[model samples]
Target chain A: MTTQPVTLRRRRLHEIVSPLTIPLVTLLLFVLILLLAPASLPKLVTGIILPGLTLAALYFLIAAGLSLIFGLMDVLNFAHGSLFMVGAYIAWSCNVGLDPLYPNHWPVTIANSNARFVIGLLVGTLLGAGLGAVVEVLLIRPLYKRPIYQVLLTLGLVFVFDALVRSVPAWGSDSKAPIKPSLLAGSLEILGRRFPTYSLFLIVLGLTLAVAVALLLRRSRIGMTIRAGVQDSTMVEALGINVRRVFTGVFALGAGLAALGGAAAASFIGVYPEMGLEYQLFAFIVVVIGGLGSYSGAAIGALLIGLARTFSDHLVLELGLPTAIASASTVLVMAVVLLLKPGGVFGAKE
Target chain B: MPINGRRTFQIAQSGIGYVPEHRAIFRDLTVLENLTLAERKRGDLRRSGDLIFGLFPRLHERLQQQGGTLSGGEQQMLAIARALVPDNRLLLIDEPSEGLAPVIIEQMMAAIQQLSAYTTVLLVEQNFRMASAISQRYYIVDDGRTVHTGAMAALRDNKPLVQTYLGAA
Candidate 1:
């Protein structure tokens, strides 16, 4: 009895301190790297850091949904990447059109590339959200009681989505680069370095979405249901909440975000049949590094990974190391983070 | 007889508030959020705040603290307060005294006793003293079957029945 108050106070203290550990260590390491690296500070900031932030923004686009879906439902949605690919394809079709020979019937034509690009993003997000809702109702809702079947169903969806995209008459497994609007096509100088204006657009978009999502999670009634449902869904149900409906809502929200990410990526990297799978892999890594079901974790994880990959690639180019090392760096960081904190940086303690 | 609804949430929506044995509050949420989410309809919580706060003033004090941070006794109070937030027709309280300190149990019993003046309580408890203290009637179940039922006063005087079933009342 005498020790209880002390224990509770100590626990509160630990809770306050634990979340800061990873970010502080990362910042310290970043400072150390800055001091030791041969490249000038301005060069590193322009050439490496800005690009890293851009990539991080893109990763967050996909990973946020992955983290939310996994956190709430405990389902490892392999098709998340496939959904990302579909979004890209949709955005591509909107911007570039399926066939050049056919009269461009799309209301906003290539003549209005900027409007078309914005329209493509909106359409992709809406359709992606719609598709996600449909999938949850038709496929996932029934398999809630059986864990393995849910896994199989989602895994199978990857192929289905991939095949469906490839089957599109003009798309036909070909990589297509959508035309960039003239307004955003040019480069902008950032801190004495020229950077793609579109990359900055992506960074801004990512940060905006992150803030919006955080606000939703923190403030709204639906957000309350989500946070509570994530912790103990059965109890939420017992408290008179329709957790199943929330599940569907979350799944749709995640899908919409991933689709938005894909649409945005299409403008940056162009779109291909396998674009989703490539981005999905990094998104998964980001989710794992940030902690499963943790949004802030995913955001930070994206930043860490984006910067890690960028810096490692630069180092590889400068030192003439194997290209494989650049790719391996993110995974190496994951392994080390897992070793130190197995649940991910923001993961709930087991 | 069948209840009004099919699902747990549906039944909950049908005006039944359940306080589970383990005090299954949303540990991650603040005490205020836990109460706010319990509202069945818009402004239900605002309408019911006076009664809840009156019953458990400690909860009002710890509005911003996480449910998990609360002590067992405080969690029990929050659980009961959560149930009271919605205009529940009947409250199903399970083992309010289970694992609580004696002082906390006495306070819980007093709160239940006062609330009973306004609401119907279906309390399932093994603590005979706490049960008898707050209740006007009693039922004895032996192996999932009710073997005896009577007024609390009658049961207290019936020493043989208590000895036979409850083993030294």
Candidate 2:
């Protein structure tokens, strides 16, 4: 009897300890280093933590939309990242070129940072939605039963869009300009450390949008259909819900959100051709880590990746590790997470 | 069988409740969301509310819970409830007692019987006893084609036919 209790206790301990070991050990190591070698630590955390968080938030924004589309439609939208890039360009052109083209009717405020931000967001969303709808009608609608064909077609679209964007340099002359709003131009002191106000704004915006998304998914009727459609789309169709429209709406919503993220990031990172690729890779990692079709998991995964990248940068510099080696820490961490939980942190196992 | 145009519209307008042979609950959505989405209402929340909760009381109780977390019986009930929600004039329910306990099957039957008061149901049941109990009319689908169509009473009374066709004593 005593032996059985001891064995049971050991089994329970193993269950608790095995899953938590890596995070706990990593946390302890970080804390110990902070306590003992505070001076050796790099300024990257202080300098880049906020920006890293902002980037992660941007990733979450884009991925949330993509995840929703994948969950509901079971289609991998390879053109999603391309759609995001297009949004940034649209915003840039709308604020700069379009204003000049239609000067008499154009609002003078389009030149300003705040107005450009609003215009960019609107234009990006609409353009993305329109593009998605058109693509669905032309390409995706026909390939509903053929998933492999859908993926290949979308992948082909990415290259086509990339070429189109590269050819359209004349659309926006001020592509290099970083349009930070005047309200968020200044720095603020936090714990005797100065932080950019724009970073703070980005963080606030990302979190606010995340919360709004959660509420919408839980409360709204359309949101309910989206949630259901993710599981069994055929049943939704059979119920006389006009599932084709739902698919179009979901695809558009996802593409729009990606565009919004791209537009927002363009204000900070500047409009560059490869900007979407950088975010796409990170967002894909976040989605994998969070689990497929789980909103809460995505949020948690984003925060985790954000903090990990920040901390890893600090650790590498502080430890005098090779810059390239240190830079690959995020990938290493993601690999480890996958090895530990194959289905991801919150994903359901088949 | 050639379905007439009028029958097609009737099936389309009055929702077709399809309880999948496999797990079809949206793995991401809550029980209430599944039920609500199944309704497919334009803007009438009251109609959806009355139909969904009225059919399955358990769904009302576990509205916030994820559909994936429910028991087999509850999932079955949720599937049925989802079909019945949208003021569906006709309901098509797949096997309802496939993996349910005796008590749960009884409860399921009661719910289906109650549903018959408001909606015309076309139940595809493997359980001959259960099918005979609830159906006013019966259609035996063999090899994806209808082989028998008659009143439930006629089918029940013909013991030899039941034995030969349904493998039921």
Number of backbone collisions per candidate = 0, 1
For candidate 1, the lDDT comes to 0.83
lDDT of 2: 0.70
DockQ of each: 0.56, 0.36
In model 2, pairs of residues that clash are A72-A230
Candidate 2 DockQ vs. native: 0.36
**What local lDDT does model 2 show for residue B42?**
57
lDDT of 1 by residue, A38-58 (tens): 578778987888889999998
Which pairs clash in the backbone of model 1?
none
Docking quality category of candidate 1 according to DockQ thresholds: medium
